[model samples]
Structures are given as C-alpha cells and as structure tokens.
Target: MGEAYKLDCDICAYTENIFVGFGLLYMRLESIASFVQDAALKRRIEEFIGNPSTRYDAYDALYVCPVCQAIRNELFIEMESDSSQYKISYACPRCASVMQQEHIENNVPVHLSCPACEKGKLKATFYMDWD
Candidate 1:
C-alpha cells in the first residue's frame, strides 16, 4: 500500500473519503496511463502520476480538496474503513450527539448509534499508543 493521506475539506473540514476512496479504486488498474487513447491526454496522465509507493498526490493536483473533484463512479464502492484512526478520534465534532446516548439492556450497556455511520457507538477502550 502507498502512503495514506487524510484529505480534509477546506469548507467543512470534513474528510473527502469518497474522493480518496475512488482514487484508491483506480490505482488498482495496471498501466493506468494506457486508458487514455489521446497522446496529449496520455502524456499528461504520466506527467503527474505518482510512484506506486506514494500515490494519492493526484488528489491535490487539481483541487485544494478532492471533494471538489465531483466524481461519480460506481467503482467508488468497497471503501475500506479507516477504523484505526477513528478509534483514536471518535469524539470528532460530528459525533457529539451520538456520544451522549446510553442504555442498558439485559444488564449489558448498549451503545447508541453513531450519527455519521448510523451503526457505531462510543466506547472507552485502552490501547498502547504505538506512535
């Protein structure tokens, strides 16, 4: 895998997960430069295409934030969760509402649903910080 970058929206400060997600989708294509039939366009693709190890520079090539790219690709499915990062930053501003809900069922605490994901909950857990 190449370097992982967290791209934030300039306007909302929301990360453009979809843009990075779709870029990741296309990076799987071998010889991505081959898709363009036009020599001029093909040349341009090669000019800015990053090394396989440090891909994703393209996300910032044309826009300050990738969300402005306005992409709509069906291949944008199958996004991998950046769960490890989320584990550390669960109190993001967007989750403030979800963080306050708690209920007990059958003597077990059932965490409330996350507003952003609509399927997660807040839980306090400990881990050795490796970084």
Candidate 2:
C-alpha cells in the first residue's frame, strides 16, 4: 500500500478571486466613463443618480402559455383592417410557435408542437429583466 498524506489547511489558498476581478472591472469602468461623451447618456446617468425611483421598467408585459408554461414577449402588429388598433402576438422560443395574444392569454397554444413528446402541451410565461 502507498503511504498516506496528512491534510494541511495552512497551505491551502482560500482568498476570493472574484473580488480582485471586480476591482479590475471598476478600473475598466472608470476608463470607459472617460471615453463616453453622449449627452443623453450623461443625462440618464444623472437622472438615475438624482432620482433612483425613475428607473426603467425591465419587464415586458406578456401572456404566458398554460401547458408548457413558456414565456413570450408581447409585440403589437397592425391588422389588415381599417382599425388603428394593433393585434398582439406571442412567440415561443423553443417551438417557434407564433400565437395570438387572446389565445395565449386564454392559455391556448395555437401553432406550436412539442419536440420532445410530439404532443401539443406547450405553455408560456412572461419575464422581465433590468438593464
């Protein structure tokens, strides 16, 4: 049998590397801020600094599917009719199914089939993220 080695905690390095990387990132951010000269960007930064509550809304309001629970971003499309109102449509990322907003809101899958089981059990959900 081979000789066993004793565990040594003193030799182990446990320092956080992420914090060092973040410090370097902050340096890079300062350099980038010096290069940016757009007036709109400056105004936006000032607004964010002055009134933090006036932040951009991250979520795109959408209807989700009932079966598969897929999240879809709602987009407005003008209808062929004379009405000025636009119709909403939801698209599934996995199945590439384009469904009308009314049907998706009602929890119905209009044009997508599940690739795994070949069943029409697709669903949708809405999601949002901050910039």
Q: Supply candidate 1's per-residue lDDT for 42.
A: 49
TM-score of 1: 0.20
Q: What is candidate 2's lDDT per residue for 81-122, written digit by digit as tens?
A: 232222335556665566433233223343434334444433
Query: What is the lDDT, from 0 to 100, of the residue 31 in candidate 2?
Result: 33
| lDDT for each candidate structure | 0.28, 0.32
Q: Give every collision pair in model 2.
A: 64-124, 65-124, 68-122, 68-123, 69-123, 70-123, 70-124, 70-125, 71-125
**Per-residue error at 116 for model 1, in Å?**
38
lDDT of 1 by residue, 26-51 (tens): 55323545553557544544544443
Best by lDDT: 2
Clashes of 2: 9
TM for every model, in the order presented, reads: 0.20, 0.23
Cα lDDT of candidate 1 equals 0.28
